[model samples]
Target: MLSPLGVSYLGLDDEGFAHFLRGTGAPFASVGALTFLFALLSLGRWGLRVMLSQKHPYEPWLWDHSWRHELQDQRLTQLLVSWPVSLVLLAVLAVVHWLFYSRVFSQGHVLPGALLGLVLLGFDIIIFTRVLGPTVLGTLALLRFGRMRLLLPGVPLELGSRCQVHLEARSLARMSNVKVELRRIREWAETTGCGDERLTQSVTHIEHSHTYTVDAAALHEGKALALPLELPEGGPEHSTALHASRSCHWELKLSSEVSSVHLDTTFVLPVYYVVGGHPARAS
Candidate 1:
């Protein structure tokens, strides 16, 4: 039987549920329910913050956009992004606790394995930093390229077509030498095996590439740099059309390095023929 709230159970299974009860905390089921709820809350909070940032950005609840008054917002957006990660870590910890109670693991084994799990999640965090870093820390604090406008000769960009590209970028500080590369990259995941026992692998392929030098003169006022490049046929199979990746994708990759940090970005575009992609909306 379960509580009226449907959160905790009164009776127990002799093995799994009973064993779970005798741990450090009481009423493990209630705790588990709360953990998931907290996780959902974290997810919701971050998502709401993301939407709000685009609008109010920073605010004085009583007034408005208080963040604008200051050159920098004191609140760290990275912490907001990290709250959900804590929930993930908690969920994993609970699972580790379950593994111990289930007798599937020994006491010593659980600690190391749980630590390994945390380490892996720690690694996954770099993704958030890279993705949201530019936004959270501002454009100058991170390497960012914006408003990349590519001009192609007559037809849609295709095999052996030479073109000029222009874009604006921001960097943490000025460097003596900076280089830019434009390339087409293909990435996809493939799964092998049957039903529940399948294996998936991530694959990234660089189909074409060209490099240019961005001189310090253009860095003045974050000016757009004009680059000249030539394209090679990615393949007979790959289309010039840049489309969002479902299982596979062909992306226009723009990248560079500043100091020790690798700064790169990609735009979806058609580099071949007739592959369908979403078109830009005109204002």
Candidate 2:
């Protein structure tokens, strides 16, 4: 049977399906199967490492790694993973179209072929808009505002203290309604189910937050606005683990209206707890 997404499922018993999967000799099928197996093994290894680290308390380098570096790494990683997955989906679509065309042409069936062609066209539009379109738009947006930058203090933010930040932009003089918000977030992963049916998902919670508005006069002067934010007291400290399974951190979100354009951006903040003039434990 074919689903709304044009995915066809064969009605077979578990053992028969296993046999069918084992008998398949398609190159793309083999690649996908191997990739799934590799992913399963990698997840198992990562879970084992997480369990071991809990017992032996190893410090994560994320504490020392600057948020700017993390931001860059995240963007690069997204591009790397998204491009390959998008290309693979497009290839699969091509393979499915070819197979459908061959079988339907041999049977001289125009109706089924036309229906499947429409379905494939729908899938093509979805893939382009959801994957390829966002990538192109993000690249263009980066190019448009490549010169604008939000500068933060080099020293890490301590709990119950204040930190200074600024936005440097040559075009900000023409913008108005500048707003900034600092948010504290807690994140973790929860797993459900047992054995091969297990599933894991990441969760985020906003623990604390604050917002500030830049003065219109600052924009009129065409100078960078010095933004100072106060950290909340008696809250969780910044903590990150392997594969980012659990963590607490802060982010600064900025927005402004510039004539026909609206500018919005977010930056990760380095917020850590300090004790006796030294970085302390995570809460």
Candidate 3:
């Protein structure tokens, strides 16, 4: 005995109604699966772009350390990384969908599973787009607001050696009360607790700092005002070394009174020292 809205009202038997429904709606369900697949690939691409943003393949030095060559290399490698592996997860999802489809229609039940699959796919896409859209838009807005240039004697300043630093600034509008500074930072990570309870945390020490105030008149005249700094050797190479457990670093900072807002920019000084040799390599 068939029911109200389907084949039963028209006098078809239960098995014939089931066959008609499954065979007819199967095409639409397959299309939904394909849509979900496209959304998954798109979300993966965006995640790879964000994860690799911190990697600058064009760095003056260390450009090719572990395949930091093309942006796509990072994306492809991340796509293949273990744990929540994309292809594996996709295969698992496919298997689950097929099982649910068979269980629903083959067992003479059709009230929910097919529709739920489409709902789940749409929900995931909604969540992904919502999170990704704002983050990308805001980052682009910030980059649009400033143009910056910093000059350095070079990377890896020698211990107890004097080095010259130059910083130049230009803006679309007049900027005033500009200042520049060189700061030495010593940083390390410490692990506390034990076993499964263990946790790692960072430590930072402001070893020393020197500041230079720019003449307001120079900025107004508009010839790319140059601010210079002289730094003597502090010690140690950057923590970027693969074997390093601690890092010693320096930062060059710039701040200017722009309209009513203070604009600030900072650059890390990548200096290293050589034993019984020379100061940090020339910037």
Which prediction has the highest TM-score against the true structure?
Answer: 2
Judged by whole-model lDDT over C-alpha atoms, candidate 2 comes out at: 0.61
Candidates sorted on TM-score, descending = 2, 3, 1
Q: Report model 1's TM-score to 2 decimal places.
A: 0.44
RMSD of each: 12.7, 7.2, 12.9
> Which tens-of-lDDT digit does each residue in 1-283 have in candidate 1?
3222112221223453445445534444656776798899978766765566456422212111121111222223444544444545455556544544344233334554555556656655664565444444434433243323433333334545567655455532544444666666666677899889999987778766667665645645566456565666444345432223422233445555565555455544434432232212111
In candidate 2, the residue pairs with backbone N, CA or C atoms under 3 Å apart (3 or more residues apart, or in different chains) clash, namely none
Q: Estimate each model's TM-score.
A: 0.44, 0.63, 0.45
121-168 in candidate 3: lDDT tens per residue?
Answer: 875476446543433433342343344555555554444556555444
Local distance difference test values of all predictions, in order: 0.46, 0.61, 0.51
Q: Which run of 10 residues does model 3 get worst, by summed lDDT? A: 64-73
Top of the candidates by lDDT: 2
Q: Give one digit per residue, the lDDT tens place, for model 2 in 1-283.
A: 2232232333333443343334443647756876998799978776766665465332323333324522321343455667677767776766666556654445565666677678879988999999987666555544444445666665556778876777665545566557888887778888999999999998889877788787646645767667788877753345322244466667788777665445666777666666665555464
Q: Give the least accurate 10-residue stretch of model 1, judged by summed lDDT.
A: 61-70
Candidate 2 off by > 4 Å: 1-64, 67-107, 118-122, 193-199, 216-222, 235-244, 257-262
User: Which TM-score value belongs to model 2?
Assistant: 0.63
Residue-pair clashes per prediction, in order, are 7, 0, 10
